[model samples]
Target: MARSGIQYADVQQAIDALLTRGDAPSVQRIREVLGTGSFTTISEHFRHWRNEREQNRDVPPPKGVPEAVATLATDMWRQAQEVANEGLVHYREEANRKVEAAQDEVLQATREAGDAAQRECALAEHLHHREERMEALGAQLADSQAQQSALLARCNNAEQDSAAWAKDVGRLKTRLEQQTSEHAQQRETERGLFGQQLGEEQQRNEATEGKLLALLDSVRQERADDDKAQRKRTQQLQARLESASEEGRESRRELKAAEETQAQWQRRYEQAENEARAQHETVLQHRREAEALHERLLRAERTLDAEREQRIQEADWQVSLSQRLDALQQQVATLPATAPENDDDKPAEDHSDSPPKT
Candidate 1:
């Protein structure tokens, strides 16, 4: 028979075959059928089978064996068993072959299951890594969004500031234009006034130049006349001196009488010369007084011209003021009249209704 502890079903089949053949089976033949080289391994299988049989004693073996087969001899029985064991060994070998095949299939399936579990663990790790990457990307996206919002807000504020500055610039430009126009008008008015003053001053200067030229011509004429009178006086004095020298030479013959007459004539000539000098001084003094009077008249004329210009300016101002006053009076005259209150403290209308006049 195959080893008794080989699968119970397998051992039972071999035992059945031995009983049917009417022979005793040997241990060697059983070992050969079991295909086990180690006695220790066969012993471990028998111990396991004995323990299982004790626990489940009521269950029968898969194949039935007669009780007589257990009592056979050692040597003749071994030989007889060899004949019977031949069929039993073949049956046991077939059964053990099927069991080994099933065990190898189970081992392959277990290895495949372990490989699948390892792949599943690796895929789970990859998924976790991808999730962490996605979280970091999401955080970066959020920060970028916040920064964009801040930039947009700053742009909006800058736009508002630009608009305000533009408004201020426009207001300042308008004021500048108005001021420039007013200044231009004032400058024009001042230019007109200065032109008028320049014309008046030019006229006064021309008049003064004419008077000065006249005065210079009179002085030159006076100097020429004085030079002529001085030459005549000098010729007269030279003639008188020659006559006195001749009379003195003649007087040497009549010394006392001629000397007294010559002295008297010299005294009279000296007195006349002194009187002429006094008259010349008086004429010079009168001429200087006349020149002073002429200068005073020129100054007075200049003052009069200035006064006339001032009067003209005053007249223009008065005329403007009068026109303005007239306009104001006309405005006042055109205004509506106020009503007086009566004894009843109610205002009365003073309307004089008439046909509309053209």
Candidate 2:
């Protein structure tokens, strides 16, 4: 019972028995008769049984009925025939027994009548009672025949019901097998679809992971290139700054040297100016001495003429002294101008060492 839940075969047998008794099987009554069954399980199978019955209900009974139903019907008819024959035998035996009893009474009456003529009237009365008894036995035999006919009709109806039920059970078994095959086919199709979808999703995830790694490498390369460019630009700017700083220091040194040289030239100009003034004073004194000497010569010439022959040798000495004085005056005039010209020539030599302009 546990291995097999209530099946259509169980329900079919139960329906056949109920149908033979002319009672319709219901869910509640089938459970009660089986003694161990789920109401829902019984109800389901019962529905299937009813469907089969409806399909075959209108069909006519077949001539070649199953052997089991035919055998059962044949046995019932044979039993009815045997019972009727036995009843007929009992009726004939009872009639014969009554007829023998009446004959024995008639024999006794004939013997008694011969013994006495006065007893003949009593014998006639006994014959009338025997006729009444015969009529009662005949009525009982007619009732027995009527009961045998009714039994034959019930047996015929039972055979028809059993044949109809067998056809219904056969149709239900075929339908159940078809439904089971279709359900198995549908399950296989759904399983295949699920596996295909899972494989596609896995492939998509792998492709996405590869793309993410490529994007990361590209970003790192761009960052390295930017850093290299920044360092190169910084190096160029540093070089330019150092070059400009060296040029600035050199310019400062040149400016200091130029300022020192200008101060030295200014001192030299003051000293040259003082020497020119002193030279001018010395030239004036020399001119005065020459003028005094010229006047004395003129006095000397006049005296010579008075005593020419008295001092001829002294006159020749005075002429020589005048010639030497004129030559000394010419030398003093040229020397003073030429000294300042020599002082101007010294600055040109010093200027050559000074730095060029910025």
Candidate 3:
């Protein structure tokens, strides 16, 4: 089973937060902040992020050896060329000497063979008249002819050897030319490879720069969204507070009206009590005139008591209503001045779409 990590937006937010805290983001640090990504996945994304950053920035070319070293290399190459040319001249001279020497030996052998033949002819002419001398002259002529045939064979062998040496020299020269061409081609290939590597590095740098710009835009957009949300939440709180203020005003009006009604009832009760007192005084004066009036006076006293009790109950109801109104005003006062739009300060919950950030 594999655990998923946060969404790209969340990861970006985390990175921005880390930057705000002056911390660099690495695979391990990002994972620690996110608390859920696989190490391999984090490593891959981090590599991409770093590449984007590098592309946005300029990268200087790698420093090679100092100018002194380059000068030294040039001098060494020149010396080697000079040395090779000298060796080639020496080799050609040596080969020509060998060929000339071989030809000279062949010519000297030919002249000696001709001289031997002439001397044998002279001996034959001088010895022709004597039979014993003629017999000895025939043996010498046979030996000379054998020696001439051996010399001819030796000359033929020398010619064949000379031809082989010429072919060997020609092949060696061709091989040297091929080696020189191959060395030149090798240097060309090395230059091509270096140029290709440099171009690739430049391309990588450009890509990194583009990515950094995109990330910056994303951060800006997110900030704008946050600000908008805050403004909306503030407006909502203000509207709620206004509604509560209206309700409080309505409650206060009702309370004031109840107090006015209570005062009117109190005035009515006092007027009734005054009337009862006047009737009691008239009853006391009439009791002396008529004993029958005494019963009416007692009934009037009972009616006054019932009316007083009813007024007391009404006053109690008014007081209860006033207290409830006060309580409603307190509740309206206690309402919060502003409501939160979201719990952004707290860590987010894990969901299918996104993981938690630490």
Question: What is the Å distance of residue 21 in model 1 from its true position?
Answer: 17
Better of 2 and 3 by lDDT: 3
lDDT by candidate, in order shown: 0.48, 0.48, 0.50
Highest TM-score among the candidates is held by which one? Answer: 1
**Candidates 1 and 3: which is better by TM-score?**
1
Which lDDT tens digits does candidate 1 get at residues 1-358?
A: 4334456455444433543454443334335556653444443343344355345544443334443433331233345434444545555565556556555555555555455556546655655665565566556555645655564565556556555655655565565556556555655665565566557656755775576577766767686775576567557656855665565454444444444655655565456456545655655565555556556555655655665565566556556555555554444443322111010111111121211110
Worst 10 residues of 3 by lDDT: 338-347
> Can you give the TM-score per candidate against the true fold?
0.33, 0.22, 0.20
By lDDT, rank the candidates, best first: 3, 1, 2
The lowest-lDDT stretch of 10 consecutive residues in candidate 2 is: 349-358
State, as a TM-score between 0 and 1, how close model 3 is to the true structure: 0.20
* lDDT string, candidate 2, 216-236, tens digits: 567666756645754574465
Number of the top lDDT candidate: 3
Model 1 residue-pair collision total? 1
Look at candidate 1 and tell me the lDDT of residue 236.
69
Error of 3 at 318 (Å): 99
